[model samples]
Target: MTQKNTEDPSSQKNDSDCGCGGETGCRIEAVLSVDERGQMVLPKDVREKAGIRTGDKLALISWEKNGSICCLALMKADNLSCMVKDILGPLLNEQDRS
Candidate 1:
């Protein structure tokens, strides 16, 4: 028996079709499968292209809409920390005023 490609066509989008209308926007690089142990391996080429190396840490982020998970994203741990600070810095300031 053969398995059919179950990938969504929209997920095969390029940067232009990312709905962001930007040349440097995100793209659907590859589809991955999680094993029975709930582990997934990033393809070697994809990892190389993204500059991911051994012992690197990644932060998993999820987006929810209407109480359902809509998207999942991964970013470098250091970058994630910076982003959290950038977002929460202003919010923390507001709390100080209150």
Candidate 2:
């Protein structure tokens, strides 16, 4: 289900490029479709750019706004683990000292 974005950037209809008429740092990279089995394939380009390889673990993170999920993100499991440890490790140590 991988497809290349052949559309030319210049020909893009949206004049909302940016206030400076330059590309924005954050923009849509690819659109993915989910199959009947609820399986979706991340575009090859996005996967490669993100350094995702076969069998790599990704944690699907979601953000809730006003009780509704507003955004979704993916992070490497190992990095997520490191972040959790960095944030909670100190708190746990403080509790142990208490």
Candidate 3:
């Protein structure tokens, strides 16, 4: 049996039959306060849903569009050069001797 999360009916918005809407697909607002140390804590449930964990790096992107600031979090891009060096380090060293 699956457990259902209870939501307030009063807060529910009428969904359009076309179903094209926000990225979350639901209209819910959550307000959070930032600390004095320039840190904002992500809610546990939101973090878990996004597959974020301790020691996992995240990139913060900020943009100014339409007179408002927008921020987003994304996974860090891998350094392909580092991986290539690790794989071809021995072969490159041998070539330098010739």
Q: How much lDDT does each candidate structure score?
A: 0.79, 0.80, 0.61
Question: How good is model 2 by TM-score?
Answer: 0.65
lDDT of 2 by residue, 1-98 (tens): 99999999776766333232335355567888989999989999999999999999999987665676666778899889999999999999999999
Ranking, lDDT, top scorer first = 2, 1, 3
| Candidate 2 clashes between residue pairs 3 or more apart in a chain or in different chains | none
What is the Å distance of residue 63 in model 2 from its true position? 1.4
lDDT of 3 by residue, 2-44 (tens): 9887997645666432233365465433556789997888788
For candidate 1, the TM-score is 0.61
Candidate 2 clashes: the total is 0
In angstroms, the error of model 3 at 16 is: 24
Q: Each candidate's TM vs. the true structure? A: 0.61, 0.65, 0.41
lDDT of 1 at 48: 91
